[model samples]
Target chain A: MSAQDILVLAEVNQDAVADITFELLGGARELAGATGGQVVAVLLGHDVAKHAESLSAADRLIVIDDEQLADFSPAPYLAVLESLVGSEGPRAVLAGSTTIGLDVAPMLGAKLNAPVVNACQQVAVEGDLLKITAAICGGKVLAEVEVSASPAVLLILPGSFRPTEETGAATVESRPSPVELHRGAVTFEKMILPAPGDVDITQQDVLVAVGRGIQQEDNMKVAEELAAVLGGELAASRPIIDQGWLPTTRQVGKSGMIVKPKCFIALGVSGAPEHVEGMKDSELIIAVNTDPGAPIFDVADYGVVADLLDVAPALTEAIK
Target chain B: MNIAVVVRQVPDLVEPLEIDASGAALDVDEVEFLINETDDHALEQALLLKESGGGSITVVAIDFGQVDDVLYTAAAKGADRIVKIPYDDDDRPPRPAEAAAMIAEAVKDIDAELVLVGSSAHDELEGVLAPLLALKLELPYLGVIRGVKPGEGGSVTAFKEFPGAAMAQMNVKLPAVLGILAADQPPRYVPVSRIRAAMKSTEFEEKETAAAVPEPNVTVLRMHHPEPSGRAEMLTGSEDEVAARLAEILKEKGVVQ
Candidate 1:
């Protein structure tokens, strides 16, 4: 209660500060401002000090370098966070809603009896109260959560905020990484990748995703023409791919590949919870469907309530 | 060894949804309830563990939205036991932390050596339930786990989804909770007859410990229907007109050559 520290855990991967870590700092700084507190960034990794100079968003940087922490294991990481929260008694803890953050935040919340707000896309201060807006029902609805408890841990969604414009070699404090839990009950074995095919959808910046609304197999030519005119790759929802109209490689959804393209044209795609799970993160989601009540419109940045058959070729011709 | 899989019933997203008169809650009467999506994957993981290693799996569901049907489905998928925590949709835990509290109590009473839950549930949407439950049970937890296999000793090897479909192979100690994203395989489809047979033979134990459902620390003051931010410019009129407008916007965004 005394320190009132606003802490952000700076996560590193492949020897660099990940973008999400920077995004968290951007959030932490804004939160720190309203609370009249100091923003502290904690870097825990092997030789992670190199990243200390880049987290300019922090008022202070605490670097804990340990070879044992080269990989993320919940046991040791939780031990470190628990001990830190115990000592610092921060006002709020913010981390990226990433693989590592997801693993660590709730565990910390549980240990401290603090509440956790996950996947909050926005954080703001409303008259001395900290508030977060989070997606619910796969983005069909939004919930603005206000914590009843201080020192609440927030797992923030990435791409929600912009990073600090400038870099500062913040005042650095190096602490000997805790050796108390030299090893965790969990151990990392190896890393494996999903089977690769001729087309790597992950690299595509824009995708023309079709769904059952595309109707007959022959109708796909219109989608292909639209995709070609747009200079983007053609993909499909699970139903279309399930019908063998496209290879698994061109599928987009929870069971398929998770993609964050710069722009996604969901032509005739009915946004199911599973499908939205994968593509909701797109920068701009344009949903075109005949049903004005299509669930995709709930999260779409632009909506065209019309049949794809009428629009696809007309759009392709217009573009050409 | 006993593995406890936490299942929750939620408003089936495919069905129509209506906000109740209270504004803060959904109209449970109108909405169809189904087992939360992630929970299905979690049950699959537990069943996979049961097959690979000699163990019994106990499926636990907080009574709501076709709990018996989902529990029976789990039985047909080979869960050895089932437990239902009597809960009222009207008076259910308002937040994920509180929900985890009820689940943690049930897990302890069952004396489960391993816990599996969906990475995220529809109702909570916090993506924190598994970790919160793990903490409440004083167990190590992992999130967004794809595959799980019982390891040589008292540990389990898990495949975790990373950026770009990469996976990190990790071994966790037993008595841990895993937030499952996918299982070793799609949950086996249980035939309707098997589910019916499960209904006849499988017995459900009600946890009397959850009688005192605690009040939520967080409360929603009001509810809001999204006002289309006006940022989302709707395209209307004739097909050609809409298409022309879209093309103009695409060209401005440089999405088109």
Candidate 2:
């Protein structure tokens, strides 16, 4: 009814903002530019105002700060977001397709009876229609979807949108969450961290990953050496993790972490869709597999048909 | 406790999917199909919960014609009943909404205190079915559930894996739907004897197909292997020479300082 306001739902954990939040803001900026709309970032957390300036790119920043909202509970988070969406009637709501966003986006969409496009790679607004593209069937195909519903909720793939440092003197407003904080039906459990060195790979600019072709667990040192040379993190295919050669957090595939590094070098990795989809957004992909026909080459920017044992050490030495 | 599990026979993960000449759909003829890996996890969780709670387990699948053996395999894995919704030859590939609708309708009659589904289907529809099914069933849905326990008063509590070093426990009222993540647990192997007996003894009741599957609006324009960037120039001579040559290559590729 009113002028379309773009709502960007900010996902926070333990009083820290998620990286994808800024990425979604980048995308919202582009969408707002095209549609003549204002970007309004909705943040819910305890002391949320402390992080308001970081999101100054938004035309308007709405903060719902409550002590009960310190941790991420779907009841409080979803209720606040739902209330904001209802009151503002944003033309579209965008969120990062992370684990938190994935949980909250759909719930918000279902509550509003709106359609949601999840894990979209690209979005374009033409007049009133919004066209979103996402990798489908793993990374073998790309599907372009058009959403016609009003106040559409979209889960955008992280790293797909590059965050720009163009800050504006935007206004920030603090508001009370209309939703009451009911004792959640869910309880808080202990958090289990991934094994040491199995930290966030999505934030890294360069990644060196290994696959089953490396032959044995001990032999993974060659790939690790290469990663060290590149100043990058070590990642792996599913089989590597399944074999216990690498931790599950280092696994790069549909089930594991999805990374969009600046450069991704795969050693002895076949390009399975599950694995490829996770890294397809990497700016430059160099896959070194003995098998020339390995699927990894399908989407790789560069391919080398050679054994990783020879190629990996050589590359590492050369880089050194 | 009564648990319902939804499974689908999808193209084997190890085998590559081939696109048909039309480029519109996968060439199923070349690829072998199996129970989706995540779906297997869901079935295993259901069986585990059933064993723990002393309950019955019903496994439901939308048979898309090529994967009848997968449905029987579910029975071998410990499903008490299997319902197959036959695929309409004329209809398009079953979408998440359609499968969820069929599963919701079938489970309506069955008294299921909990419904479990694979977090994501291996096919194009990954992680879409469970949430859609939860909406259709009007049940609170939990995604990426790694562990489940029977809480007090006929309620189920699950530890869901969240991003960035976080885990959330959701206590759902009875008759809730859960989507099990693929990494939740390893699927148990069924003995050969059980497999053979399941193949012969499993009885499938087919449900009426829904309306003509809507034709997909978007179509793949073409499918082809990506063109290789360039050949790696082999470097020979001393390590110093090799390093120098490699640095030059990286500079040429704009990868180095």
Candidate 3:
């Protein structure tokens, strides 16, 4: 395949564009510059064309608007994406490593017979090979993968790329999806948006996270009080969320939100890689655990060896 | 509601891993092996599905070495049958594609409506198994599934966790494979009595490895602790002064103007 434009699958939800779409556009801009190619952002979903302004960083925006594409279905989305890639023949396909991208990336890679990389924190064009660095082994290790194949598919991790406010006059064009979506094989029942109270630690600057050490639901008040003092949000480890003390949205781990807060105060967190991977990018990591040998200390910039219940209140008082 | 769960015995996460002197493989002697934590969630989901739907559950353990003990543990947790793929000592490390192939083969004979595997393994291959298995099995696949509810008409609706306050629920056609998220459900602990009974009563039929184990193309050059990050560039002064200093630091760090 010839060296062509870099195709970015711009993700949109409920007529609003996802944040990662611009983050990917940032990376695609860099890649396109290196490859001497244009960045084409592929926008899908009904009424998604109106959000084309967000893709201003791209050189061109390709919109595929369809009523069936309103909701995210693997069959319809993949069908549209596969057709676009086939016809466009872009040098590489970039997407956010979000839920939709994770589901679609590998399948697209398999279909196109190209190499696919997921959760990549960084990407650079190194000569002919696309060098991608992704968190491997539960974020304990960063593996640099070299993809030599053309038309490669990549899923960039959320928050990995800094979406700069670089303005450009991107030309917008509309295209009809070639593949007809069949409702017989798979069907969508409804779209349930998470409640407003959902825990979104990724957007926070500081997070006071509780873990199994908090022990009981009532005891979580200590964490809340500390969070209030720190002006941060209250998050939890998987155990706390699994126990129903916290909603699944509040869980901070590999499967949960990958947070990069300015200050992350992990209370009673054991710092498993799954959890650590989510918070390793934090500017300041302070772990308070009773166990001195807890893995949280490995990544924490400052570690206080004391009971969370005791230390949390003291810290809260100090901050106040 | 027949369910098939894939459990892989991976190097325990707690243990420190060492790359061999050749830098080609991990030192097995230095690492302790346990069921991949994410796969345990898959098994738990399978058990819960079986219990709720009153269907048979089969747990398949795809390992490169001895794993009977792990199989017994899975059985105690509510696996009705276990399929063990016995690998010769000379066999190379199992690739994700090869493991997926073996799993697809094992499920070919069983009338399983859904196959659940971990979203990713802790050791060796990570996050590549379920998709590869889905491709091999020619079934629709979903990854990062936090919760799954068996739906009407041989469909399984899965709640997938997305980044940044987003979730997508998709109803996969029957006989699909789901890569379970670690944050899905807490793993269930089997009673000691049940474990003992499973250890004695459960028998695994060892099947020969079907696919040719692919050689690992990628190699880890060396393993070392990551260089420590973050130096405490503290600023001490009056509240306003401290804020000004912090902002200066942030500006220097390119965080703020």
| Top candidate by DockQ | 1
The residue-by-residue lDDT of candidate 1 on A103-178, one tens digit each, is: 8887787678777777677877665466777755645556766775777788776656677765755689888755
* Cα lDDT of model 2 by residue, A68-179, tens digit: 7876655577778888898899888998766567667776876776667665778889777887776554444455667667788887766668884768766888877787
> Of 1 and 3, which scores higher on DockQ?
1
Off by over 4 Å in 3: A1-4, A195-207, A211-233, A238-245, A252-263, A268-285, A289-301, A305-320, B88-93, B122-127, B164-166, B182-185, B212-225, B232-257
Model 1 interface DockQ: 0.45
State the weakest 10-residue window (summed lDDT) of model 1 chain B: B211-220
Q: Report backbone clashes per prediction.
A: 0, 2, 0
TM-score for each predicted model, relative to the true structure: 0.83, 0.78, 0.82
Kindly list the per-residue Cα lDDT of model 3 for residues A142-231, writing each as its tens digit: 556677777888877666777747788889988777787665345566665658866567899879899878977789999998778667
- Score residue B51 of candidate 1 by CA lDDT: 81
TM-score of 1: 0.83
Lowest lDDT sum, 10 consecutive residues, model 2 chain A, at A135-144
Candidate of highest lDDT: 1
Candidate 2 — what's its lDDT? 0.72
